[model samples]
Target: MDYKDLRKEYLKHRLDPASLHADPMIQFKLWFDEALQAKVDEPNAMVCASVSAEGKPSSRYVLLKELKEDQFIFFTNYHSRKGIELFETKFCSLVFYWRELERQIRIEGIAEKCSAAYSDEYFNSRPHGSKLSSIVSPQSSKIESKEYLESELKRISGMDASEIKRPEHWGGIGIRANYIEFWQGRQDRFHDRVCYTKTESGAWEISLLAP
Candidate 1:
């Protein structure tokens, strides 16, 4: 199979400089709304990239659980590979791509742990099975077999909702973005790129980049 042939032209939309929002967060919300209207699958799913203490980089998709005034939030096991790296470096990048809309958003940010209270609130709101799994699964650790997980799940399945509490190792990470770039696909790969960088005075400076 020739992989070079697996390509398609982007002719869906074009982004205008004047149409961009002064605030990157606002711009993100606007695109997010459009993504929802376009019926993009899991529009809130983002690729979270983190670097280890040794400068090794890794990425994985995580659901965007919340978007705050200055942060993007997601939850995971604190002991997970990404989580450990985040704790160590506190530096990360998030990417959101909506193929259906021919658009992508890139964010560079600092990662911080959310309050324990907030984590508890979100955890309690999750489905029963999810809550159970979070407790049983030692994320990013080696496990013996699928049967072990099945057995663990079975043991905890009978616990009532009140009995299930968010474990100490499971919580939310909020990323405070300092730079954001928005990309819109155009004809012949001449894409539109608009970016926002935070200034020293906390103002956002917007710029257009060549495609």
Candidate 2:
């Protein structure tokens, strides 16, 4: 197979500044809803990027747990790479791509820990195995082998679900976006791009960008 010969031409949609919502969060929810309606797989999954105090960058996929008050929420172990990095830098970015819709959304902003009550509410709503995995698996930690994780899960198996508390090291964080960009695929690679940035006065300014 000739790798260079493979290509995809985007013709799914077009995005214009005039058609966007004044609030980027509202726009995001609209797109997100469309994605869900279109039956996109894991539509809430997004790429989370963070930088460490040493300026090292990290990226991974995390599921969006909630969106409210212009904030996007996700959960993870407080000791995970992303959590530690956010703790040190107080900033992060997330990218959502719905290939079926030929669209992508990028967000950048400050990240802060959610209230413990909110975290607890969300954690309690998770499936039993997900809660157990968080309790047993040391996310982002170097372990000897996969067997160690399996053994740890086994160790927690006998415990009652109600008795298993949300680990102190695991919880939720919310990204309060300062900048948001929406991209839509166009024919011949002239993709459409629009960016919205928050101003000091709490208003958003929208701009069109070159593809």
Candidate 3:
């Protein structure tokens, strides 16, 4: 199969500033609502990108837990590579790709750890097994075998739910976006790219880019 032939057919939507909400967050909410209505699988999933102090880039899939006026929130282990990188540099990027809609959202921003109280609130809302897993696994760490993890999980499984707490190394990070770009696929590779950036005066300026 020719890899280049795997082109997207994007008759589903088009993005124009005139049709967009004045606030990017509002636009995001519109798209998110559409995704939900379409019943796309794992619609909350997004790609998070981080760069280390030494300039090494890493990215992974993470669930988008919340979206606030100025920031997007997700949880992670503070000691993980991405977490540590964000700690040091306080910057990251997130990408949401919904193939069913042939659309993507890219955001770049500064990251900061969310309040511990906020972490606890979300932690307590997780399933029992998920809470135990968060407490048991040292995320991104090298372990001996699956049995080691299973045993640890089993040990904690018997504990009372009230005894469970958010791990000290686990919490949430919120990315306050300085730039956001929305992409819509088009026929013959004539994709559309629209960008919104925050200016020094704390207002969003929108523009189009060649794609």
Candidate 4:
């Protein structure tokens, strides 16, 4: 099979700089709403990339829990590899690709932990099984076997729901974006790219890039 032969043209939509919102957050919401209307699966899923202190980079897909006026939020274990890296570097990138819509968004930002109150609120709202899993799972850590995890999960599940409070090791991390780029695929590979960069004076500078 020829791998290079498995390409398809992307002509579903076009992005215009003039049509973008002055506020990147608002623009993101507009596109996010369109994605929802288009029935894009897991539209809030994004690839989060972080680098360790020694410059080793790692990336994984995570759900975008909440989008705030100043930042994008996602939750995870504080001791996880990505969490540790994010806290150490305080810099990360997020990528969202919606194949069904032939669009993508890239964001570079600073990482910060969300407030404990917010974390607790979100945790309490989660499903019971998810809550148990969060309490028992030592994410990114090696364990003896699957049985160990199952046992731990079972143990946690047996406890009273009210007793299962949010662990201090698990919570939300917010990314304050300094740069964001929106990409819309087009015919003949001449895609459209619009970039928003935050300036030192707290203003956004928009620009177009050649595709």
Candidate 5:
């Protein structure tokens, strides 16, 4: 199969800077609500890009667990590669795509560890199986075999949910955005992008970018 020519034209909607909310987070919530209304599959799924101290980059998909104040939140094992990378460089970029809506959201920000209390609260609310898996697996670590992981899972399966506590190495991280860009695909690939930058006085400066 030939690979170089693959492409799709975006014929969805136009994004206008003047119509966006003054607060980027509020604007984000509004777009997110539309994604939900459009019934986009896994709408909360987002790609998080992190850079190592050596300038190498890694990207992966993580579900957006929560959005609070001016931040976007997600959870994972603190020992994971992304976690360690963020520990070294306290920042990351997030990309959220709602294909059905032909829209995308990009965020750049500082990632901070959320309060232990908040992590515990969300951890407790997770489904029982997810709670068990978090306890059984050492995320991003090499394992001898799949059997070993299954055995560990089996070993912990009998434990009551109340007895299983959120592991010390697992928790939530929140990203307080410094910049956000919203992209809406338009006819003939003439997409519209509106970027919001945080001003020194705590205001947002919105701009339209040539697409």
Candidate 6:
């Protein structure tokens, strides 16, 4: 199969600086709403990219659990590769690709761990099985086998839900985006890309880039 021939022509979905919300967060929410309306599976799932202090970059898929005024939130094990990278550099990027809508959103920013209280709240809200899994698995660590995980989970079967607490190594991270890019597909590969970057004055400046 010819890889180049696999490409599909894009349909124009133009975006302009004037048409965008002054607050990039609002714009992101609008796009996310559209994605939800389109019934995109796992709409909250996004690609999280982080670079180690030594400059090695890694990316993995994670779910976006919350979006606040100036930050995006997701949960993970603090000792995981991405978490360690964030701890070292505090910078990361998030990318959301909606293939059905032919749209993508990219954000770059500094990340910080959310408060312990917040982590506890979110953890308590998770399903019983998820809470048990979190308690049993040492994320990013080598496990003996699937049976080990199953056996560990079984041990917690009769535990009371209210007694389950957030693990010390697991929590949420919030990325405060200083740069955001919105991409829309167009015909003939003339895709539309708009970037919003925070200036020194703490205001955002929008610009268009050639695809």
lDDT of 2 at 184: 96
Whole-model Cα lDDT of every candidate shown, in order: 0.95, 0.92, 0.90, 0.94, 0.92, 0.90
Candidate 1's TM-score: 0.98
Candidate 5 collision pairs: none
**Model 3 stretches with alpha carbons more than 4 Å out:** none
**Candidate 6 backbone overlaps, count:** 0
TM-score of each candidate structure, all chains considered together = 0.98, 0.96, 0.96, 0.98, 0.96, 0.96
Error of 2 at 144 (Å): 1.1
Q: Compared with the true structure, what per-residue lDDT tens digits does model 2 show for residues 30-133? A: 99999989999999999999999999999999999899787899999999989999989988999999999999999999998999999999999999999999
Between the candidate structures 1 and 3, which one is better when assessed by lDDT?
1
**TM-score, predicted candidate 6 vs. hidden true structure:** 0.96
Lowest summed lDDT over 10 consecutive residues: which window, candidate 3?
8-17
Q: Write candidate 4's Cα lDDT for 119-168 as tens digits.
A: 99999999999998888888999988989889888777789989999999
Q: 2 or 4, which is superior by lDDT?
A: 4
Candidate 4: 10-residue stretch with minimal lDDT: 152-161
What lDDT score goes with residue 26 in model 3? 87
Give the runs in model 5 whose Cα sits over 4 Å from its true position.
Answer: none
Better of 1 and 5 by lDDT: 1
Top of the candidates by lDDT: 1
